[model samples]
Target: MAVITMIEAQKRSGRFNIYVDGHYAFPVSDSVLVDFRLYKGMEIDKELEGRLTAADDVAKAYNRALDYLSHQLRTEKEVQDKLTTLEIPEDTIEQTLKKLRDFSLVDDAHYAASYVRTMMHTGDKGPRVIRQHLRQKGVGEKVIDDALVLFTPAEQLAVGTAVAQKLAKRYQHNSTRNREQKMRQGLMTRGFGGDAIKAMLDAVDLTPDVDEQHALLAKQGEKLWHRYRALSESERQYKTKQALYRKGFKLDDISQWLADFGESVD
Candidate 1:
């Protein structure tokens, strides 16, 4: 048996160091000290000391979890990950998570819904992108699916159109075909499905006028001309024609430009 020789407050708030047999034993939160009614001259056996120590660990783990949650809404897995990184024992982490759930502080469903809303309204993200982000954050599939119910097809089209329109404006200087292609690639990278991308493309007026087409052809053609300047004239024309073809320009347009530039076709 060991006798409590002293109790002293720690420099950190809400914690105290205990002394047993005139030597330092352990530090515990104020709540743990009060719950265990620790005081000087109290006698404790090894088993009781172990129990108090475990209880103090639980209290500390719970407090740390609370502090982590206080800053923002967190998914259960996110909270678990943070506690695990802190090196809290598994059983204590489970207990802390249970308490948090009971108090409605950590709920995956709620977190998923809020996440979807924020991404749609503020981040301008589509459902697929939002779902991918939630999955990466360790939210369950069912929870993610349920949360995505809020993003209806009509709503998705609206958001997709808004995103596509912005990109279209940004690429207004490019040819119609190049601008449309860029817009599609950008939306695909952002996780919009093919159908959604098609819908957005169909809605946008991407047709270039005669002047715009001529300007784009002149700009791109000059670059290609310089690149193939070192090649034989015949090879240069063939390669430049192939290059412009791959860039979504019609063959007729390329032929017309070649003729206007006084380049003879084989």
Candidate 2:
């Protein structure tokens, strides 16, 4: 057994420095002090001292966890990983997590749902992208699935069509096939599924009329013409035809443009 020789308040708020047998022993938050009823001249056994120390550790760990959560909403795993990084003991971390969850401060389901809504409305991300992002954040599969239930097929089509229409307008200079292909690739990259992309492409008007095709040919043809300017006329014609064909122009369109420009494939 040891006698508590002194109990002095520290400069930091709500903390106390305790001494046992005339020597500094440990520091504890006021809550711990009050809970244990520690006072100068009180006698305590080694086992009681050990229990008090453990209790103090839990208080400190809980405080640190609260500080971490003060910035933004975090998933349970994020908080667990952070506490682990701090080297808190596994048992203490579990206790701290229980406390946080009891207070509803660390709900993975709520976090995942909020994240999905924010990404869908503001960031305009698809379900696949949102799923991947939630997975990376350590949200459980079941929670993510439940959260994604809010994104209905109709909603997916609405978002996918808006994105596809934007891409179609941007690439209007390309042939219909080329414009559709680019739109598909762009939607897929943004995390839209194949079915959604197809639906969007089917609904949008990507066909290039004669005037649009002529405009595209003129714009692209001028560059190609300059590129093969040094070649023989026949060779330049062959190269330009091949280049336009690879760029998704039809054979009839290329042939007419070549004839109009006084160039022959032969």
Candidate 3:
């Protein structure tokens, strides 16, 4: 048994240093100080000392968790991982999570729903990518599924069409077929499913005007012509034909462009 010699306030707010028998024993937050009712000349037995330290540990861990949640809404797993990094004991971390859940401060369902809603209204991410993101954040599959109901087929089509249209513009210099292909690929990469991709393709108009197609072909063909310049004339024309064909130009269109190109060069 030891007797409390002093109870001194710490430089940090709401913390106190406990001294027992003229030697520093432990430090505790103000809440713990009040709960344990420690004062000078108070007798401290082994059990009481253990209780005070254990309670102080919990208090500190809880406070840390509250501060962590203050900046933004966090997943329970995120909070648990954070407390674990601080070297808080597993039981203490569990207790802190329970306290947060009890206060409705950390809820995976609410987080999942809010995330899905935000993505549906303002983001270009498809349902699959959103689900993957939520999974990585440690949200359960069931919660993600429930949340995804907010992203209906109509909403998916609307967003996918908008994204596909933007991608088509990026590939506008290519042939219409090539632009459609690139837009499909971009939609796929953005997590749109095949059905949604097909719908988006149908919705977007990739066909350039006849004059625009000729101009685009000329712009692309000239680069290939310059690229194979060191080869023999026959070899350069052959290579240019193959390159432009692979770039989604029709055979007839390639022939016309080549004839026009030959005339321009001569």
Best by TM-score: 1
Q: Model 3 scores what on Cα lDDT?
A: 0.88
TM-scores of all models? 0.87, 0.86, 0.85
Ranking by lDDT: 1, 3, 2
Model 1 clash tally? 0
Off by over 4 Å in 3: 1-11, 17-24, 33-44, 262-266
Q: How close to the true structure is residue 37 of candidate 1, measured as C-alpha lDDT?
A: 94
Over 4 Å off, model 1: 1-11, 17-25, 34-45
Show where candidate 2 strays beyond 4 Å. 3-6, 34-43, 87-91, 207-209, 232-234
lDDT of each: 0.88, 0.87, 0.88
How would you encode candidate 3's per-residue C-alpha lDDT over 93-174 as one tens digit per residue? 8877887899899999999999988887898889889989999999999998999998899999998888987898798778
Error of 2 at 175 (Å): 3.7
Estimate, for each residue in 97-182, the C-alpha lDDT of model 1 and write its tens digit. Answer: 88789989899999999988887777767888898899988899999999999888887888888899999999988766778889
lDDT of 2 by residue, 152-181 (tens): 888788888889888988988787668778
